[model samples]
Target: MRRNIIPIGDVIAVNQMLERRGSALRVHMHDACGGQSFSLRADDGTSADEASRQAVGEFFSARGHAVEFSAGGGDFWAVRP
Candidate 1:
């Protein structure tokens, strides 16, 4: 089982890396609850899913929650144990 609440430092580092890479992906950290969420969109239409999948596959795969990518808009979309 994966732990949903990862270290805040890891989240920060990931965000920093994203910024450095100029990636459209962004990780939203919930400090009050230690939950993380991300949403991505690309002008090319296909980049959104690709980016979201890659981002989540690399990062959140080990976290407590799994991100389900869709063309939806919500900060807290879904959380699975």
Candidate 2:
């Protein structure tokens, strides 16, 4: 299975929006090949980074994929099965 890497810029933008609104948000994406998909929702009241990670991690875990985040803080990739 091919991996799906979420861009850092996208994550950073989403994080910034969540931080500004202090509200819940959802992000949905499908793999380039259209074989896999993910939906993530982040609730309000937590740090943007943490909430984003939790949502992304849950999406991957439910689909039996491993979640990996970049060291710098604003990106993630899913290791496909």
Candidate 3:
């Protein structure tokens, strides 16, 4: 597994834009080798930020990675468990 830190603000902004367009927000992730990609959809009635966090958590968890959040929720990083 690898550690990848994602900016919270950017994810939230993109999700908000998708919400305004009545489309589901999709978070995509690629494996460390960049050989595979996965997409997770945001759930309805949940804030984009929260949904993003959940999706990221689930993604990392499935691959035996650990997800850690930064102080004040500014960002998150996924790494080997």
Candidate 4:
């Protein structure tokens, strides 16, 4: 999986486990830029989902983003905005 790490601030917080509901492949962003939700990668397969999730977490950490993932597991990447 490949994802572009956008330099946003602390917005996402919480661990999302996509084992049950699979996973969210993309999301829409409503801001001044104005554009549809960007599709960074495909989260359909099992490993793909895991890779995407880990990438997201690492992306946030690399940018010093203040976010947290679910402690154990879940199906959604919880965020706080």
Give per-residue CA lDDT, model 1, range 1-80, as digits (tens): 23355566666766666667676655565554544555444334424445545664466555554555445532333345
lDDT of 4 by residue, 1-81 (tens): 222333333223212332233555432222334321222333453223456657656755655543333333223232333
Off by over 4 Å in 3: 1-48
Instruction: lDDT winner between 1 and 4, please give it.
Output: 1
Candidate 3 lDDT tens digits, 1-81: 566544455445545655675656555444455433334455553334665656556655655556765553324456546
Q: Model 4, residue 54: displacement in angstroms?
A: 0.3
In TM-score terms, candidate 2 sits at 0.40
lDDT of each: 0.52, 0.54, 0.52, 0.38
Task: Pick out the ten consecutive residues of candidate 1 with the lowest summed lDDT.
Answer: 69-78
Residue 25, model 3: Cα distance from true site in angstroms: 7.4
Q: How close is candidate 3 to the true structure, as a TM-score?
A: 0.37
For candidate 4, the lDDT comes to 0.38
TM-score of each: 0.46, 0.40, 0.37, 0.31
Q: Which segments of model 2 are wrong by more than 4 Å?
A: 1-48
Q: Pick the candidate with the highest TM-score.
A: 1
lDDT winner among the candidates? Answer: 2
